[model samples]
Target: MAALRDAVGRYGIWSAELHTVSPGERGEAAARLEALGYGAVWFGGSPGVEDAAPLVEGATGITVATGILSIWQHTPAEAGARFLELEAAHPGRFLLGIGASHAKLAAQYERPYSAMVEYLDGLDAAGVPASRVVLAALGPKMLRLSRDRAGGAHPYLVTPEHTAEARGILGEAPLLAPDLKVVLETDPGLARSAAREHFARYLELPNYTNNFLRIGFTEDDIAGGGSDRLVDAVYAWGDDARVRDRIDAFLAAGADHVALQIVRGGTPTGLPADEWRRLAAVLGL
Candidate 1:
């Protein structure tokens, strides 16, 4: 667990668009992220181990991880084999993040917990060590599994309060890296709007809404593209200082690392390299 935390460091970048580009472009961007001083680069959008391989190859020092590879998409044998290949090539630089995903997205997403256990079992049979893997866990049960089975939990759409609870369950050892959305805009209206635009889709997912409800957000807070309070709590917006403060809150609440996902208005595609640079400056990465 200490090795995992040190490998990922205190901060990392999570991007859905990073996986949409060509292999050469992706590699170059990954190298730039390492140059910018980010500890890890998480390949978002349900990426496979193969998707993160180029990032591991491109960045010599930065840890490259799957924000989450859905268990339904790839067999554990296939994932484990690919993981081993990347490990042999890059050694400690690769971390495998796996998840059950949402029922809406996966046609076979029934009995998620049991299925996750089975997937981990298969990975074990395929010789993928639990220490090299992390689980995209949300609730207590899965969080417990993350502590007992994998190296840690990589929770998405979570708050610092959730981080505190997860850390309690993990007992100060397993990595607790949560994905945090950031909008660099300063205007309250603009920042909340951008956050709502990015958060709209997630609100439709029951898994997220359920988690939100569990974490104390009311139905009204979840309605109409989320309330301002909900938006502010879940996203780090306003200015550099505010962003840093929100990220620090997570650390204070007991997160090993925070994975920042930049949310820009208009279309949520293309790499936000400038934003990443600005964030690196603000974070003193």
Candidate 2:
């Protein structure tokens, strides 16, 4: 846990477009993130560990995580081999974040809990230590597994209240890192619009909807691209002070760290570099 904490501090970025960034520019972006003092960079969109090694090699003194690499896509042997290779080149600077992604996203997705258990077993056999991995867990069963087997849990699209409930379940052992969506705009209408644009696609996913239900969002709240209350609860929107307050609330709710995914006004792939800098200043990091 100490090593994990040292690698990913209190805040980081979970970007879907990071891997898509041009190779030449990706390293520069990573370097800029390090200079801005973000503790970690999470490459989402189900990247393989191989896709992340170049980013690790590109930057210094910052943790690089998968946000989650889907179990169905990468075999445990391949993942473990890549982990070792990356670790050899950059020790204590890479975190393996694995998940049982949505059913619709993978053709072989079935018995996810069992599959994740088996996957972890294979990783163990392949020499990837439990401390080097984190599970993208949402339910109690997976969260317990995260504590018992992996370094911790990395839950996505969660609220502060969910953070508190997850902490209670984890009981202070495993690391609890949740993804928090943020819209930098101060205007309520514009912020919610941005949030909806980022969230509408997710509403169709049962895994996320089920988790939202567990966290107390009603079916109505989940419908129509999510209700205002739902969006407000899930996103940290507004100016720097308001966003910082939201981050503080999550921390106070027992989050070990929060990985913020900034939802910019236009394309989510636009890369909100300026907003990242603003958040760094607010977080004093």
Question: Which candidate achieves the best TM-score against the true structure?
Answer: 1
Q: Rate the local accuracy (lDDT) of all candidates.
A: 0.93, 0.89
Q: For model 1, what is the error of residue 119's alpha carbon versus the real structure, in angstroms, after optimal superposition?
A: 0.4
Q: Residues 78-169, candidate 1, lDDT per residue (tens digit)? A: 99999998888888999999999998899787999999999999999999999989999999999999999999999999999999999999
> Which ranges of candidate 2 are over 4 A from the true structure?
none
The C-alpha local distance difference test score for the whole of candidate 1 amounts to: 0.93
TM-score of each: 0.99, 0.97
lDDT of 2 at 204: 91
lDDT, residue 197, model 1: 91
